[model samples]
Target chain A: MAKGTILSIDAMGGDAAPGVVVDGLAALLADRADISVLLHGNEPVLAPLVAAQKALAGRCQIIHSDTVITSDMKPSQALRRGKGSSMWNAVEAVKNGEAGAAVSAGNTGALMAISMLILRKMEGVHRPAMTALWPTLRGRTVVLDVGANLEADAAQLVTFAIMGEAYARAALGIAKPTIGILNIGSEEMKGHDEVREAHEWLRAAKLDIDYRGFVEGDDISKGAVDVVVTDGFTGNVALKAGEGVARMLGSRMREALTASLMTKIGAALAMAGLKTLRSQMDPSNVNGGVLLGLGGVSVKSHGGTDARGFARACELAADLASSHYRDEILANLARIREGGLAAE
Target chain B: MAKGTILSIDAMGGDAAPGVVVDGLAALLADRADISVLLHGNEPVLAPLVAAQKALAGRCQIIHSDTVITSDMKPSQALRRGKGSSMWNAVEAVKNGEAGAAVSAGNTGALMAISMLILRKMEGVHRPAMTALWPTLRGRTVVLDVGANLEADAAQLVTFAIMGEAYARAALGIAKPTIGILNIGSEEMKGHDEVREAHEWLRAAKLDIDYRGFVEGDDISKGAVDVVVTDGFTGNVALKAGEGVARMLGSRMREALTASLMTKIGAALAMAGLKTLRSQMDPSNVNGGVLLGLGGVSVKSHGGTDARGFARACELAADLASSHYRDEILANLARIREGGLAAE
Candidate 1:
C-alpha cells in the first residue's frame, strides 16, 4: 500500500553484465526520488563500480552473492544450484518482501523457471505467460507466451489471452483492447485442432474483451490488434523474427542512404525522419518482457540490453507493482475456471 | 515441351476462388504467347463471362467438371473421392504427362498429399519438401519443407538442405547458395536434439555447397543465408508470418501516408517510391511454392493469388524444368547417400 521502496535487480545477468545494469540503476535512481535499487551481485565484483559513482556511494545497496547463472545453464538446474547467484538472489529479495518486484536479464528459461517455481502462479491462474510489448508502426501491441511455455493446450492459450488483455490495458493504457489469436490464417477455421478449439471457446466465452477472430504474424508490428495471443514456440519465433527483420530493414535503409553521394545528401536532409524511424525500430522503447499470471512481478530485459533497456524493465516493474493487475487477472480467471468447473 | 498446350486449370482452389482464380487465369492467358488455359467448370457457370471477354474466345477452353474440392476437405479423402474435381483432374494431367507441370491453388494439405502420392518423390529423395522463395534484403532465399513434413528427422533435414540448395542455385541463380539450419539460436548447442544433430551432420557432410551453420527464423528475411532448411512446422509458421507481416506493413504505411492533408501531397510526390515499395512487397512476385524433391515439377500458387502470381509460377515451372533441377538434386543426394553408406 505504501510507496514501493526498491526494485531488486540481477546485476550479473545479461551480456552487458554489472556495468550496464548498474548504469541503468544509476540513471533510474537519479530520475526518480521515491524508488531505490537493491543490486544483487558479489560485493567484491560490484563494489568498486558502486564506489566509483559518487551518487551511488550510499544510495544503492549491493547484496553479496557468490554464484552467477550463465546463459547456457538449464532453467530448472540453474534455479536449483545457483542459490547465491545474482538472478536468484534478486528474485529471493522480492519473495522475502525486501523489494516490490525483481528484474533479470539472465537465461530466459531460467528466469521463467525460477519465477514460476518460487513465486508460484497467481490465484486462479492455470499458467503464467511471457508477454512482450511489440513496437508497431501504429503503436505497441502485447504478444503473450513468447517463450515461457512451448507446449500449451487450449485452456492454457485462453489463459494467455486473458492475461495479455490485462497487461495491454494496464501497461499500454488501451481501453477495452481488442484481442486476436495468432494463427496460420485470419479465418476462424484456419489453425490446427488446438487453435480451433481455443477459438471456439474464446468466442463463446463471456468476458469484458473484444475477441477479434484471428490475426497473422504481420499484425504484431503493424498494430492491427492490441493483444496477440499464441503459444510460446510460435510467439518466440515470431518475436525473434520480428527483431531480425527490423534489423535487416534498418541495415538496408542505412545502406541505401550511403550507397550513393546524392542519397547520402538526401539522408542528411531527412535526418529527422530517419532518427524517428530508427527510434521506432529500436528495441529499447519496448525493452521489458513481463512474466504474466505470476503472484509476484517479474520482468526480463533482453540479454544484450544496455542501460536504457534495463531502466525500462525497472520502470515496468514499478508499473506492475503499483497497479491492481494481479487482482484484476485473478478475478477474471476465477470466473472462467468456475464456469469450466460448473460445466464439468 | 513445344509451348506446352494450354494446361487445364481448376479455377477454384483459394479462399476467393472461382472469381479471383478465373480472372487470374484469364489475365495470365492474355499475356503469355506460349500458354493457354482450359477452365474446368460447368459451361453454364462461365458462358456469360466468356461471352463478355472476346479475348478469351479462342484462348479459353472450358471443361465441364461439376465437383469442387472445398478448402476443408481431408487430404486422404480429397485424393480418394475428389476424383473428377478440378484439382484432381489437373494433377491427373501432370501424372499422365499430358501437362509438363501441374499448378494448383487448392487446400495445401490436399495438394501436397496428392503430389507426393500421385507424382511421388524423386529417386533417392526419401521425403519431398514444399519449398517457397522469399525475397530478402540480400537477394532471395529458398525455404524448404514449408509444410511438407511436420515432424522430420536429422536425415530428412539434411536431405531438405541439399535439395533446397540445389533449388536455390537452379531457380534463383545463386551459385554455391549458403544452406542454414533454422533453429532457436545460432549456437551449435541451442535447439532440440534433432536440430543439433542436423546442424552437425550438415556441417560435417562433404557436399558441393557452402554450408552456413544454423540460421534463426529472423535470418530467413535478413538475407544472412541463401537457403534456409527446417522441418515443415517451423518453415510453414515463418512463411505465414512473413506474408501476414508484409500485408500488415503495407496497410500501416498507407494509413501513415493518408494521415493528413499535407502528407497527401507528400504521398503524391512520393508516388514513384510508393509504387516501387508496393511492387517489392507484392505477393505476386514470389507467390509460387515449389514442391521440391519430386520426380516431376509442381508449383503451388497462393490460394488467393492473382494472375500475376500465376504468371510467376508458370515462369518458375519453366525455369525448373529447363534448369534440370531434378537431375542436380538427384546427383547431390546420390553423392551424399553414397558417402553416408560408405562411412557407415
Candidate 2:
C-alpha cells in the first residue's frame, strides 16, 4: 500500500453527485490498496454508501457539511457563500495538509477560483494553468492552459513550458519530456507576437526542458511531442473541438455497425477489437484535468463524467501527489528567473 | 446547363499539380455541364493531359504560364516575383472577367497574397478572411478566418460574422443562415473582450443574418448553426485540431477493423455501411477554403489533397460565383457602418 497519500473528495459535487463519487471511490480503492480518502459531504447520505462498499469502509473518512456547491453557481457566488460547503471543505483538507490532493467533479470555474484562494499559487508561479492529458498515436501528451485564463503573454507562455515539462514527468513519467508550444505553423516567424516571443525565450533560456519550439494543432494527435503549451482560449477551443470530432466519429461508427443484418453480425464478431478501440477513444477514460502551478495537487474531473471517469481523475491526482512535480517546476522557474529570461 | 460561371485553374500548383489539376478539372466538367475552365500552366505539360480527358476537350481552354510558384515560397516573395506564374494567371482570369472564380491548390499564403493583389478587398471590407465548409452532423457549416490574420479585434470579429453569414448562403445554400461566434462558452459574458463585444454587436445589429448569440467549440460537430465566426488564430487552431482528432479516430478505427481474423471478416461484412460513414468523414469531399471578403470568388484547395479534393474545391468556387455571396457581404457591412455599430 502506498503510505501517506490521502485524496480529499467533494462528494456532493458533479452531475451524479454522492452516487458517482462514492462509487468512484470504491472503484479506486479496489484497484489501489495504498490509498485512502477524506470524503466531504452530508454524512447522513454518504455514510451508507461508504459502508456498502467493502473496499471503501475503513479507507474512507466522512466529513460532514451543511450545504453543497451547485454546478450552475457562478465562481463569484461560489467563493462568497461557499464557506462550510462540501466542495470548500474538500479543498480545505488539501490546504490543511490533511490530504495529498483534492479531487473535484464540481463546477470548473468554482474549483479554479476556490483552489487559487485557498492553496494560493506556488512561489514564483505567475498564474495557474489547467492541464489535461491528450491521447496521441503513441500515448498521451500533456496539454496546458485548457481554459484557466483568456490570454497568455510571452513570459507566461515560457512559464507554461517550464510547468508543463514538470507536468509531463508527473503525469506520464517521461524523464526529460519534449515540449512544444501550439501555433498555426512550425516556422520560427509564424503565429502571433506572443508565441514567437515565447519561442525565442524558451530556446535561449537553457531551462531543464527539451523545448521543440513551435508545433501545429495536428501535432496533438500525431503525438509529435510530449507537452503542448498554449493560451487558455485557443487551448480550450482546440480541446473541445477534438472532443467534438471524437464524439462524431464514434456516433458514425455505431451507425455503420448497425446499418444492416450483416453489419450487425460483423459488429458482434469484431466486438473484442471494437471494444479495445472504444476503451482508448472514450473521453471518460481520460477524464482528469490537473490544475498545475498550484501550491497543492488539484485534479478536476468532468462534471458530466461517470464513476469510471471520476476514478481515472483520482488516479491522475494520486500520480501527481506521489511525485516531486511541484519541486521540479520550482527549480525550472528558478533557472529562468536567475537567467533573467522571458522578461516581459 | 448552368451557364456564365467559368472557373480558372492553377494547373501547375499543389503537391500533385498538372496530374491532379487536369484530373480534377475533368471530374468537375463531368459533374457539371455549365462549368468550363481556363487551365493555366506550362502548355507543353498541361495540353497533352487535357487532350486525354473527353470532358476537357471542348470546355477547357489552356492558358500558357512559364513560371510555377513553389509551395514553400513566402507570400512576400510570391508577390514580388510571382508575375506570370500559373497561380497569378488563374486569379488574373477572374480580374479580366474571363473567369467567374479562381481555384488554386497551391501555397495558401502565396495564393492569398496573389488574390489580394489581383482581386483586391471588397468595398468597406477591413480584411478578407479564409472560409472553409466544415462537415457537421447535419450537412455543413461555414467557419471563417482560418489563419488569414492572427488577431481579430471586436470589429474584425464582427466583420467575420458578417462575411461568414454570406459565405454560408453561397456555399451551403442556406438563405438567411444562422450565424454564431465561437467562444469557450455559450454565455454572453464568457470569453475574451473581443468575442463578448462582437456577440453584443451581432445580437443587436439586426442584419440579414439570423444571428445566434454564442457557440462553443463542440457546436461545430453538433451542427448547431449554419456559420461559426472566429478570429484567424482561434479558427485555424480549431480547424486543424478537429482535423487531427478525425484523422486519429480514422487510424484507430482501421486498426480495430484489422486487429484479428474475426474482426477482418466482420469489417468485410460491414464494408458498404462503413464506406458510407467513411465517405462523409473524408476531408477530401469537403476540401475548399474560400477566401471571403474579396472582390471575386477564390477557393483554395489543400496542397496535399488528391484529384477528388481539387474537384471539390472547384465545385465550391462555382457555388460562390453563381450566387450573390459578395453582394450580401457588401450590403451587410454597409448596414453595420450605417448603424455605427461594432465600433473599436
Most TM-score-accurate candidate: 2
Which digits, one per residue and each the tens of the lDDT, describe model 2 over residues B1-344?
23567999999888898899889889889988889888899999988899999998788989899998998898889999999999999999999999999999988889999999999999877788988788888888989888888888889888888889888878878877898889896222398989888988887786877988788899988899999999988998999989888998889988988999999998888888889899998889999998888888888999888889999899989988899878888888888988889363
Best by lDDT: 2
Residue pairs with backbone atoms closer than 3 Å in model 2 (clashes): A2-A34
The local lDDT score (0 to 100) that residue A150 gets in candidate 1 is 55
Score residue A239 of candidate 1 by CA lDDT: 75
- DockQ of all candidates, in order? 0.24, 0.68
Candidate 1 lDDT over B1-344, as tens digits, reads 22555465666677766666666665666666576665665568766676676556676667777788888888877878788887777777677876667677878777777778778888777778889888788767898887776567888888888889888887888777888887764222376667778888777777787888887778888888999888776677677666655554455545555655655554555454445555666778888888887777777888877767876776676566557677777787777787773121
lDDT of 2 at A209: 85
> What lDDT tens digits, residue by residue, belong to model 2 across residues A69-134?
887888889999999998899999999989999999988888888999999999887789988889
**What range of 10 consecutive residues in model 2 chain B has the weakest lDDT sum?**
B180-189
